[model samples]
Target: MTAADQPPQGGRGPRRAVAAAERTRQPTEVRRRLIVDAAVPLIAERGYASVGVRDVAAAAGVSVGTVTYHFGSVQEVLSEAMVLHIERYYTALSEAAEHATTAAEALRLLVDALFTEDTDRHWRMWFEYWHAGEQGTDEAFARGQADRYAAWHRQIRALAERGVGDGEFSCDDLDGFTTRFAALADGLALQRLRQAPPLTTQEARHHLNRFIERELTPRSPL
Candidate 1:
């Protein structure tokens, strides 16, 4: 092997040695997932630019070869990490809305969950992947991003229809409103992702809530 790819000689790189044994003991699929999971926080904290395969391997408690064995390159691993992380985000939004009887309550739960401290890492990870994939060189990443956007738009449209049914929201053009709202949320999320960002999470939610009140929610009778 090339000197650059050589495993760390003396010290365990980032994670503990005891966990190394457990990391390798799992089935192939499980080990692959472990590597993806390790990459997410590393990407979130370090940014995709700074994190290398070696960093991921150390974090995953696996040898560099093990990570390469499962994923051909670091980009592939990071891409999968984005996929898994985003899937959980969508699932969380669904779960948050499940308890809400009114359309307004469902929206409040989704917006609250979307911009929380816990989800800050998630937004970071997403922006990192988005920056990397925006050039369209990564075909798989491009396709996945398109699919994810479509899914998000669908959810927004569904909620808008439900709002109409519950008499909580009204919009002359549901499709146009859905697009505008999705873009608004995306902009707010990017603002929140900035380092030392001026936009606080609460402020992001407040802006979104305000949009709902003005654009979607029906005003009281005069």
Candidate 2:
């Protein structure tokens, strides 16, 4: 055998060591997710603009090089965090909606879910994204915000269409109704976040229910 191919005198060769290390190392995708999970909560607690790779690395219990190796840049990390946050929020909404018997009930459940203490951090993160978009500091974040709103619009529109099919709503224009509902919900959420005589959870629910009642016929109890 060639000298280079020969095993070391006292221990495994460098190639064998490397192969063993690779076998024991976490998968690339798992490592990436670990970094992302660590980064997101920090970004939620402190705005994305305030977080750095070192902070993420420390939180993830990995070296800065590991974070850099998984995510090319801080912006990419922030983007991935935003995506994960949205996914969680969407899943919660979907679960709430699934338990409702009517579209109106689903909408009410969704609003309730949005205003809970658990969702407060998410809302804070969401507002940070909005602020970043307005300042033109991060184009990717801005685009992501727009995409999230579009998704919200589509979801609301589907619910409104279902309500119409059930003969619960009087609206002929589902699109307009969906847009108005989303705008109202966003306005209320912003007011709550500002906490300037912050809208109480019950008050927000009352207003949303009132609006729905105005638009939809009351379903008779069976």
Candidate 3:
């Protein structure tokens, strides 16, 4: 039912009270999600420096107080949003990993997902965070970058092992492979984010595939 259908609390009768209570419960969950969804793109697109508390509340269709009551600060709201984003990212990675039959396939899937068209918001948000962190004014931004990189490093390491096992890669230095691969993804994203036309999803996939192939190819028949 719509908001108008819900009974008012302490305004009419017991039914109104019950309806109001139910409505309140429903919105608590919903408002939180709305706040997060609104905050993500705003902070990502505009950067935290340019946006304000009122803007977020307005975007979410809530008041400034409601935003403060739920998250206390813009930093807190942004931090929680990053957490949610990473959780979704990891879940998608897990599913891709499960469906992959070979290490090459798994590695390709991981890179493809990293450079996926769906990740534009992520790339933008992450780029903003990196810029903020380098400014030295936001410790949270710096820590968030480090934490995300660590998580990606772990995933890449696992995928690297699988690639080696399937003879898709010749690298014995799995740690080195993971670190460099993760760095390559980040570097390319940063470059493309600043370049013209942006990098197409297929172009990203091709670049990643070629890089992997080059790394895995053996020199001669030694």
Best by TM-score: 1
Q: What is the C-alpha local distance difference test score of each model?
A: 0.83, 0.77, 0.73
- Angstrom error of the Cα, residue 188, model 2: value is 1.5
Of the two candidates 1 and 3, the one with more favorable lDDT, higher being better, is 1
Q: What C-alpha lDDT, on a 0 to 100 scale, does residue 108 get in candidate 2?
A: 84
Candidate 2 lDDT over residue span 96-182, tens digit each = 787889888888887787776677688777776666567656676677788888888888887778877887766767788777887
List the candidates' TM-scores in order: 0.84, 0.80, 0.75
Best-fitting candidate, scored by lDDT: 1
| Residue pairs with clashing backbones, model 1 | none
- Which stretch of 10 consecutive residues in model 1 shows the poorest summed lDDT? 11-20
Every model's Cα RMSD, please? 6.1, 6.4, 5.7
Clashes of each: 0, 0, 0
Error of 3 at 190 (Å): 1.4
Global local distance difference test of model 2: 0.77
Lowest lDDT block of 10, candidate 3: 213-222
Give the alpha carbon lDDT tens digit for every residue of 12-123 in model 3: 5665457446546765767778788888778777875787788888787666877888786887777666666766777788688869997777877787788766787788
lDDT of 3: 0.73
Model 1: per-residue Cα lDDT over 177-197, one tens digit each: 789888898889888877445
